[model samples]
Target: MAQASAPSGLRFHSQIDYAGTMKISSHAVARMLGAWQAGPGPAHQRLSDRLRLLVLDGRLPLGAALPSERDLATALGTSRTTVGAAYRTLVEHGYLATRARARATVRLPHATPSERPAGTESATINLSFAAPPAPVEILHAAYAAALEQLPRYFERHGYDRYGTAELREAVADWYRRRGLPTAPDHIMITSGAQHALGLLARTLLSPRDKVLIDHPTYPHAIRTFAEARARLLPVAVGTCGWDTAQLQAAGRAAQLAYLIPDFHNPTGMCMSASVRRRLRLACPTIIDETMTDLALDGARPEPCAVHMPTAVSVGSVSKSIWGGLRTGWIRATPSLLERVEQARPATDLGTPVVEQLATAVLLNGRQTERPDALQHLRSHRDALTEALAEYLPDVHAPRPAGGVTLWGMFPEPVSSRLAAIAPDYGVTIAAGPRFGVGGAFERHIRLPYTLPSSQLTEAIRRLAQARLALTQGATGTHTPAPVA
Candidate 1:
């Protein structure tokens, strides 16, 4: 029998084994490279540019094998030559590495001195993350109060998988304040909301478990479920908000569901009372309430669990208070809490005593509901939308009623391209694909208004310039965005 050769005309030095490497199918790559030909450029350049953006934005994981040129060409409905040229460009730029007979693998370029952001100017503004700054006075007072109570925990061993009793009750009261009855046994503390989600994912999901999630939902949640090897079933959340029929239809076959109905991430649209009452799912659901206290409109929406009692609730003060406070909790039935506590040792011992004490003080005092903080958020939100109108009139950025972000829709699919180049204009943005699986939402970008009004205005001004450059097909110089 003759040995199989590399895909058509391609050759390799040696036969490479791709046993454990993540290989993306040709069809999937084509789907991810959505509308690549629509941008201004040669076919090959356009393809390479989109591929590079996918890699840079982390849609394409590093070291993942790409489909063969011939295979991808067939899937993309392009010639093999075009695909080959694009691959070559990617290889030359260090976005990919090709072995003799092996498929090309994804890799980012090694940054040189010139590629690094220089001074504070490059750190001028960042809209990539949707988190608020610390409330200095409030945070200090809470910690001071916590320090006073720290002596109470000195007698016992510092291991508490179930968290402190006082904090758990405080977390329970947080729900009770919102019209949902909860108990201390219903709460278990974790480092933060993200940590709580990870614990739940580990405890609830097995390999290949079906998880229903909102399309273009929280990016980290997408990553968490994907990392767990769970099959994701996405229901589209449109400008009009979630479709109840579509959500229920998708949930029927799912084992677990994750939702951000309380001022949903990126889009910041809250699930209305009517929808919450009507919405029911076959699977157990996890509802994230990180932004519940940041309601800018009239009143805070009642908890989703108010309608669906079996739904688990995860919340943190990271959004409402400060990102520095790494404290959060899980609100579920006592039986579920028992399972989580049993699995807690594998991850870590427990949440920090001091932070938990401080969070208890903050929650009991209702500091997260500060009038001044909410007012500032409202003002900054207004400023961000105003900036978008004045600077990038063509882009549609709807003002969210609560969360710190503005979901911007471009006239074209320029989000990833804009994100790649935005830092050169002294701004950083979260491209839309980051929030979604595959390469969906190419026409959208999520901009956070957590910065000061002046910074928000300036960032949008710079962002508009970046958008102009991208639209004009200018492959200008690049500068890496400031790392948080």
Candidate 2:
């Protein structure tokens, strides 16, 4: 029998009614920290810090069982003593609790032992977003390079609505390398990709203008278009990919279209070159390449504009490098960008000079976390798949070639119910309807492999518990948004 493990070491049930014990795979842990080279601290301290950061960031997640020291040392290519010391350090700091034969479990360092609520436990794990934490070394290096370039801009007032010259040029160079030749004038930087989308929506859409989008698309894109008062013409993308004929069929009627052709968000499916070539949409389409750098497969697809030149591309470092960077760009003709620049200030003045500078360093230097992140992503993906197989065998989750999420299909409309009861089991999963318009895809759920293998395993276990509870007649399937 298994028992639900709480972050604060709270045990409510004497015997586990369902979900078995979880043991994290060593490969999964290694994948979570991709290209994590030796940092400034001692070996054990560095390992401890890295693990601690993962825990604090909700990546390792509380109550997940860790692999044995010997197993982890072998996986990390380090000595057992070093791994043992790291575990001891984590234990001392309250990040982990270990027994003799049992694997160590993650926990938080609390000033006081908090009391559990009368009927439920506090929510711990977050599986809503699919993106991973940034590589610490690469981020620091980029910022350091940005600081070296910051003095030149300090003399100016720094209100660069069209974007700084360095960032614009870097964005153009990125496109050129991706097989879409772009000039500096064609690139306009914004706070991030979402900001770029908002700017485009504001500039391009009139009230009730029909805009084509994927039915189960990025939630924020739907919100952006809704705020712009555009009538969305959504084309559904499935396990295979987007229906190109259907997309073109819809695009012909719309004023504008939004697409994520390369490594799509929730599905992780890459659009075929054939689809790209045949996407002869009459309207101006926007291709989001935020996840282009997160290709788990060896092949990286080219920009959509390469096949459909009329299509514009929007990109950012959020999916690839770090979400906090808030640096992204729009690739379009100078004339269109002029219109976008004019409407930019309604939202904000401009992208921060420092962030733009840092992004430039990463882009121009051709620095990416993909090579390091790919193996890790693949491992985590496999881990998630294995856990799902073990915990909820009925749910079918496809393994995508790239991108962050696994679109799982449940036999019943349990997505919303699962989300509602997940907190009681100490996990939070995004309901399928969150990604769809009109609360569709109730039987589907987007599972992110961003968390560590151990966390993924435990989260799946919790999900299974919630599903079982639903059958046992839990509360109404109305999950409130997490109070962040």
Candidate 3:
């Protein structure tokens, strides 16, 4: 077969023979000459600089086999030792890779923004959402019972804008079980936790009202507050947890403080009871207990709404059972519930009648323990943590007592870069800035341990590879480069 010609605009022969049975191309020689002439330095430094430039400039495409050290030396008018040193430097910097059978091949140090790995289809391993699977036996029975009671709701207009009495009672009972003093009249059901937050934001916040949140908090909560025109005050949350003193100070300065007291999103840090008490008194609190039921280790030490009667507690079955349920409730004073209800119609008519019935059924029944589901989640979390510890020991990560994610901190300020590289590893990880109030947490990454154990292992492996690429000194993906 005739050798392949180089792409247009270059002047070079198709092929030239080197050693016996080995062929070198003029295009490759031209790349070497261009690199050598472009620099002014010592022999080895100039050669290394040239090779790095060629790799970065796409003159040598990623995964393309490079000419042998001896051949490159002959073509570039340099010693073989100098060529070998150049290749070694590029390899060390992640610009090239070599193996026994294959020659040194050009490789971009960072993943391209558009490149994505296979096996991450919609139906495949989805680690993006951190919620767990529903308890099958309990959920199915609830649906069956709700279907039977469907006739009862058919008679009414079926739209209780505030919430149905029966469902509110169930929500109150759930809080009561946790030792909090809750009243049924204080409860208002909503489509989900996000809806509840939206209602609160619309009802309470004016333009640029200061709202306090942890540094690495829920992304949705930040967006909701921003849309409500609130100026966000973000206090950093360390590996140990939030700095309560700083939080209280920020709370005092702000109109509202949004918090996740149990199994915090992304970080999974349950608030200490002392911090909860202090925060409640310092600010009008909106507590999101979305991951309350996902405590794989044990119960949370403090009730999210325990200290402040003025605080609004947002509860949802989305994390406990299934997101498809779309049923969540707010526990607050009746007066507050009335205000939220006034703002509710602007967003939704009400929570769906059938889904409310289903959630009520589930809450009312003697729910069975979900050992299998718990075990599956626990296994995934452990695997991911172990992989991080083994492969990227320099990164800091806390194994949460509960929740579905492992929040990791990188050695460098490269979380955004890693997020861009993750898809190449067949994973989609949320960068730390996504959770922060004002684009903080730039050195962090959140990995959801919600997929199967096998998938989690593969995802972590890919993350390790991506991290290496980002930190090993290759020109980053975000940098300007020539397009092919």
Question: Local distance difference test, per candidate?
Answer: 0.83, 0.77, 0.70
289-330 per-residue lDDT for model 2 (tens digits): 888888887678878888888877898988777888999999
Ranking by lDDT: 1, 2, 3
Model 1's alpha-carbon lDDT is 0.83
For each candidate, give its TM-score against the true structure.
Answer: 0.91, 0.74, 0.72
- In candidate 3, the residue pairs with backbone N, CA or C atoms under 3 Å apart (3 or more residues apart, or in different chains) clash, namely none
Sequence-dependent TM-score of model 2: 0.74
Q: Cα lDDT for residue 431, model 3?
A: 64
The C-alpha stretches of model 1 lying farther than 4 A from their native spots are: 1-22, 113-122, 476-484
**Candidate 1 colliding pairs:** 12-100, 12-101, 13-100
Off by over 4 Å in 3: 1-125, 366-372, 471-484
Candidate 1 TM-score over all chains jointly: 0.91
lDDT agreement of model 3 with the native: 0.70
Candidate 2 — what's its lDDT? 0.77
